[model samples]
Target: MPLDELPPPKVELSDDDWRARLTPEEFAVLRRAGTERPGVGEYTNTHTEGVYTCRACGAELFRSTEKFDSHCGWPSFFDPSHSDAVILRPDDSLGMRRVEVLCASCHSHLGHVFSGEGYPTPTDQRYCINSISLRLVPAED
Candidate 1:
């Protein structure tokens, strides 16, 4: 769905609640803004039809229809299932500048987004995301 067509995120969580719900690795990446090792994420090579939801809050984030193979060592999405599902912020960490993507409902870091890198997609942008930050809900046939 388009940004204007998607519904708003309705779930919210406290820091302590999130920590309690997520595992150490999940908390590290989602809450602490840590990055997982490249090519090791669970969904890095998954091409199934489904919706990817926030691991921390189960809020819908990305859809399989928007995913593409960028061979970038992680899950890549050309566009979010809903524009309002992800929040982009300027990241100046690691001595570099990048746009960071996060779950709008729980404010968990999904990953970074890079644009104009020559990917042939509708948005010309790559949402480089971590599998740890997302939970796949496969579409019912």
Candidate 2:
């Protein structure tokens, strides 16, 4: 469904439900706000055309067209599939400040977003997402 037409966040899962729905690695990043090691994410080097959806709720979050080679060791997108597909919040964890991006549907932690790094993308922003937190559905030919 289009983000604008989608209802508000309704995919609330309990800790046990999330653990049962996702693998341990996914649970770590998506449920616990943990960061996957840089350069090791499955989507870090992916160049295929697709819509990347939240692994937790299957909500469309980003598109390959907005993805760029930020070389940040994770899938990086300059924009989302829709402006409301994800929610951004102030994160001051780990002794620093950053923006935390979460799936709007399930409130699952996808990753962080950074801006003003001098990227050539139009938005000059990077949605640094974890591979295990997303599932890419390739676009039709």
Candidate 3:
């Protein structure tokens, strides 16, 4: 679909404000479609209990209970906390086919989704997310 045909981003941020709030690296991934180095994300080896929210808008996206290791060099989740919190787009970049995931609230590029995978989780869906796109909030003890 054309760019105009797709739904508008759920959240908006001023470039100056966002820059002041995030580092250069964070801004690139969250706002400029940049990817982090493999196995470098704090959540990749994390097994803590928390909720992952959008870095740009702080909208809840995924829960810690749903997180799993997909070995895809990014944070993976079996499912999102809510359906309406995210939006999927057909990505044809890099001469490959992939389903792009975005935060419904801010339209920030979260990651991609793949199906029919062998995951230890009950759900066969894999939401391969970029760590830079999320902020983890620890669950209450």
Q: Provide the overall lDDT of each model, using Cα atoms, as 2-decimal numbers.
A: 0.89, 0.90, 0.85
Per-model TM against the reference: 0.91, 0.92, 0.90
What's the lDDT of the predicted structure labeled candidate 2?
Answer: 0.90
lDDT of 2 by residue, 1-141 (tens): 333443557798789999999999999999889999999988999999999999999999999999898888999999999988998888888899899898988888999999999999999899999998999999999
Superior by lDDT: candidate 1 or candidate 3: 1
lDDT per residue for candidate 1 within 8-96, as digits (tens), equals 54656677887789999999999889999999999999999999999998989999999999999999999999878888878888899
lDDT of 3 by residue, 51-83 (tens): 999888899999989998778888999899998
> What is candidate 3's CA lDDT for residue 86?
88
Off by over 4 Å in 3: 1-3
List of clashing residue pairs for candidate 1: none
Question: How much is 134 displaced in model 3, in angstroms?
Answer: 1.1
Q: Show the colliding residue pairs in model 3.
A: 10-105, 11-105, 11-106
